[model samples]
Target: MNSLLILALILFGFTSFYFGKSRIKKVTEKGDLRPKALPHFYGYYQALWCALPAFLIIAIWTVFEPIILKNLIENKIQISSLNEISQDELNLIYSQIISFSQGNFSGQVTKGIEAGAITYKNLLSISQGAKVSLFFCTIIAASLFAFRQINKNVHAREGVEKTLTIILFLSSVAAILTTIGIIFSLLFETIQFFTKINPLDFFFGLGWSPQKAFISDPTNLTPQEAKDLKEAFGAVPLFAGTAFIAFIAMCVAVPIGLYSGIYLAEYATSKQRKWGKPIIEILAGVPTVVYGFFAALTVGPFFRVIGDSIGLEVSSESALAAGLVMGVMIIPFVSSLSDDVINAVPQSLREGSYAMGATKSETIKKVIFPAALPGIVGSILLAVSRAIGETMIVVMAAGLAANLTINPLEATTTITTQIVMILVGDQEFTSAKTQSAFALGLTLFVLTLILNFIALRIVKKYREKYD
Candidate 1:
């Protein structure tokens, strides 16, 4: 019924647009004075008025409907009950009522439940009918008001532009507010986590075993227990693993991606570029989970076999495998952006370099590369961020053991992987072990922010130098 109402409203909006346009056209034809705005502007003006208020009413009704239904059910149940019902019990009874109403309940039905279900059904039907009437009344009233306002003197274009500006501003505000909300949520949880564990221990301590912090009584820990708990949440290993994996990924990505970008931008023929660039960029569209499976099932085992042949011990789930796969995944980001940036370098620079008796290689080395440095650096940093934040490949290819080692052949875990491990399954959110995930998240967020700040500074420096 709601879907039907929405479809009807959309049709009505379209009809109102055409009607308003034709009405305005008729008004202009009858009068000597011309309209201040275009006919389509009046159409837009009418469409907005005819639909916006009706849509607002529907939105408000949809939001309040569940609350209204729940309140009515609660009141009905309360009146029928003999004893005082607790909130949990009432919630449970409401669940049962919902199940019974939906024909999913298998247990014996109580009189109160049967009565509640019948009342619910009747009220829902009545509410649906009322909503339909209200929606039509709103549309009719709004449409009439809009039609009456269509005149030669109406500044419909100005009104539509102002309305659109306001909507765009509100959308920007919503996006900003959402980001602020996420940051605050992370900060609040991280603060809660820090209250339970020492900040120094969490940030700088070598060990990382959050499961060991699950004590019998978290609130009242003895000195020994407190020491154990302090040592349990150490994040140094996670940080090391993240940096090591990201470093390895950069090692694999930078040379290949940069060279590929340079080749495509500076050397490739049109035919080679058209085919080659898209083929390379296809890597970016490949899903991360697909990369994860490739790393886990193919790359990891291949590395293990190579290691065995060489008389070296390589873990089947090794950081090297994850990093190599991650590097391939982010290659397109670096290569595509670098190619664009390189191509954007001025033709004047290359011509001047040639005029100075510089060879093509010299022109490229000293002129184009320097000019495109900022964007190239930006692309590389963006790829580094992707590598750091990646979870799936690390989870599948690299084992979830926070071993604080620099060995790429050994199994290691990143901050993201540990956070996933900490939060997965039914978790006690209030526990120090679970809240540790937030702390890791906050730390990772800060590190990424710092990396971005550095990248910005570098870009600014080089951009100023070039510009």
Candidate 2:
């Protein structure tokens, strides 16, 4: 029914556009006066008037229809059952009614649910019918009003442009507001987490055994229970592991990705580029879960075998294996962005370098690299962010033991891996264990934001020098 209403609206809008253009053309043909705008602008103005209000109404109805329907069904159930149902039981009854309406009810049906289902079905039918009727009425009224205004002196172009400008401005504002909303949500939860766990202990303590603080009810704990909880939320180890793994990944990715990008941009034949670039980019398209599997099943075992051959103790799940696979996964990000940035360097710079009797290598090293340094740095920073946020590969290849060792052969955990572990199963939101995930997430967000800010400053400084 909704799809049919949308189709009708679209057809009406198109028809209005055609009739509006024809009306203006006929008016100009019969009279000596000309229109204030072109025929197409008038057509667009009529089409917008026909479509925008109906679209807004449909969107608003879609958002609120389920809430209104659920309330109506709940009221019917309460009155029919004489208010004997508890809130949880009512919720279950609502679920059963919905299931029955969808023909997927697996539970035994009761009289109250049957009556609720009937009420729900009737309400849904009426709501859909009213929606279709109101939408059509809105379309007809708006089209007629717009059609009457499509006379010789109507400034259709100005109206259409102003409408489009307002739309663009609203879109930008929506994006900014969404970002602000996410930050505030994380901030609120982090504050709640810190209230339960001391900020100094969380930040500076050496242990991270969240299981000690895992209680079913956080609010009812006695003072001794809280004191004996042995909660150690020290994040230094996770930060160290994250930085170490990212460093290993950058070590593997930067040289290879930069060299491949330079080769593709400067030296590769057209056929080589056509075949090679896609093959490199295919790494990025592979699912992270698949990479996790590859890390666990293949890379980890292979590293263990090599380590045993040399009589070195090597865990099957180690930071080295995860970092290696993550580096392979991140290669395409670096290579593709670097390739585009290198290609963006002006040809004149290369020509000038060549005219100075410089070799190809010298021209690239001195001229092209310098000119593209800002973009190259930007791409590397993006790759660093990607590595920092990766969770699955680290979980599969690097064990979730928050070891503070610097050795890559030892099992270590990252902030992302710990976040996943802390919130994996059923969790009480008020528990210190669960809220710690929010704190870790907020820290990661701030770290990335700071890294980006520093990267921008560095890029700006170099960009000014080069320009």
- Candidate 1 per-residue C-alpha lDDT over 344-390 given as tens digits, one digit per residue, 9 for 90 to 100: 99898889899999998898888898889999999999999899999
**What Cα-based lDDT does every candidate model obtain?**
0.90, 0.88
In model 1, which runs have C-alpha deviations exceeding 4 angstroms? 1-15, 99-126, 151-153, 464-467
Per-residue lDDT tens digits for candidate 2, residues 184-203, read 98899899988777787777
> Between which residue pairs do clashes occur in model 2?
none
User: Model 2 — TM-score against the truth?
Assistant: 0.87
The CA lDDT at 294 in model 1 is 99
The alpha-carbon lDDT assigned to residue 48 of candidate 2 equals: 92
RMSD of each: 2.7, 3.2
Worst 10 residues of 2 by lDDT: 223-232
Best by lDDT: 1
Instruction: Give the CA lDDT, 0 to 100, for residue 61 in model 2.
Output: 93
